[model samples]
Target: MAPLASDPLGLAIDTTFDDTSVAILRGKREVLANLTLSQFKDHEEFGGVVPERASRKHLEAIQPLLAQALTRAGVGFGELDYVAVSTVPGLLGSILVGLTVAKSLAYLLARPLIGINHIEAHPYANVLAHGELPFPALHLVAAGGHTLLIHQTGHFQWSIVGRSVDDAAGECVDKVAKMFGHAMPGGPAVDRLALTHAPAAHRFPRPMLNDPGLDFSFSGLKTAVLYYRRDHGGDLEEGPVLSAFFDAVIEVLIVKTLRAARRFRPKAVTVSGGLAASQKLRAAFEAAAAEAGLRLLYPPPELCTDNAAMVACLAAHRYAAGRFDDLTLDGRPNLLD
Candidate 1:
């Protein structure tokens, strides 16, 4: 089905971490402009995002990005029907920057304000890109701060069935890359090296694969990598080590996600979050979904990472549902489902 030609416009702000982004969406189907300013260089020397530094950068970049989004969308402040911001499950300082800006916009423009859960907003990114999803879907969100398996029964109804007990998939990847002396935001670096390099004779352990429940545990897997590096004189080839590491992680993710799919028998299996951009993981999931005779869905690479477009898309749905937050809305760093 074709998406609507025009719908109410919404403005979204996202500063959950180092990425400062703003997006303008028309209803849930059309994205007019989505802009993100990465803080990789700012945090590269520190090896990861520092909360204070991330917040400072967000303050510097939010206004410009917001203007760009609105200008590119050809929409005025008064034209916006709602202002949305990601308000939970992120660095407190970073979340505050975006939320503050969004609140000011909402107040000045007299537009409805919506506070969105950063994690919940991720799966909806697929909906924005691909029209609509079949109901009763299973979604896997793998990112730096979260690893969750969710069951979506309707527009706003969600149930978390599984999640990580320790480090998230992206966090594990970054930690492994850092151990190998890779630069900050190591997930991409590790992914690139892993794809190009062949696996070594050694095989990394797949954590929690044989566990009875769907919960994940990657800390042990990460520790195993550290031990391997120490035992092997700490000079193994980057390609092979990373290749093996990614293999273990992807295998565990696929096995657990497929297990949940089998239990629930969902119409579709979806993967989102920063790590969901992994080519190897995506290939594995594609095969798993096919084997299970279920449809597979995911956002594009750009959408897989943190972006305000997804926030705006979810806000549109919330707006229609009459879900609005007052000026007292506050950032929630440890918010969970």
Candidate 2:
């Protein structure tokens, strides 16, 4: 659908790390085109994102990705009412790449600039996927950099209930996969391996499972894998090893989330971020939801990862609420502040 004065159009940019992505979204929930150019190959050898390299790649790819997204969406710069960009809680250089582009577009086009929290926008992925969420929902965000449990009372109201004290679940997964000689962005690779074989005979530790508070820790678990691989050969079977690792992460996540659900009695339980794409995790959550008779909501795999569609989608709400940032907008390296 074409954007009009009533239903304003938005351009969303996300260069949080290894992906240079752009999307054209109409109004609140309608995504016209979302495109991403992954920098996986560039950072593959590093076994993790290198900030300088990620920034350089975003610069090289953002302009072309924007052009392609506009073309695919059948829209032009003149049609955009606002520019939305993820501005915080990521690599400083990488976030600046997108924020700069967004600032320039906002200044030239005389449109509102909306700076979005990458973590917060993740929960809205569920909103985009499942229409609107019922109020007071509990959301689990398991991404490359952050793992959090948020209690949402409304569109703009959120409180983090649980968070990773050490390594993020996805970060642990990537590091563990890197240990196995997998690529930089190894969540998908490890997930695929986990689906094939039974868990290793060595059962991994589920960190922070019995804690009274809803905090999480996966560093020990990841370290356990390191020690296991050290004692065993480097050529150990990967599928089973990854299976055990994935299970530990998933179990800690599921149990803690349900604990929060019980305490908060939220209307529903939702999943977000890249690691939310795991099939086994989804299956386990689905079973838990069924057994508890609680509603389970999550975005499709496409929206689960870091994408601009979710950025623009959340921006649409901020646009309506007149929550706009100025040209002085700067990237925040950590969301905690």
Off by over 4 Å in 2: 1-4, 39-55, 234-236
Instruction: State each model's CA lDDT, in order.
Output: 0.85, 0.87
lDDT of 2 by residue, 233-270 (tens): 85789899899889999999999999999999999899
Q: Which runs of model 1 end up more than 4 angstroms from their true locations?
A: 1-6, 39-56
Per-model TM values vs. the true structure:
0.91, 0.90
Write model 1 residue lDDT over 1-337, tens digit each, in one string.
Answer: 1222246689989888778889999877799988887623453433342334343488877766676677789988888888999998788998998999999999998878999988889998899878788989999999667899999898889988999999988899989899989876688887787788887779899988999789998999999999999998746787898898998999999899989988988898889999988887787789878887889999998999988899999999988777889999999889574
What are the clash counts of all predictions, listed in order?
0, 0
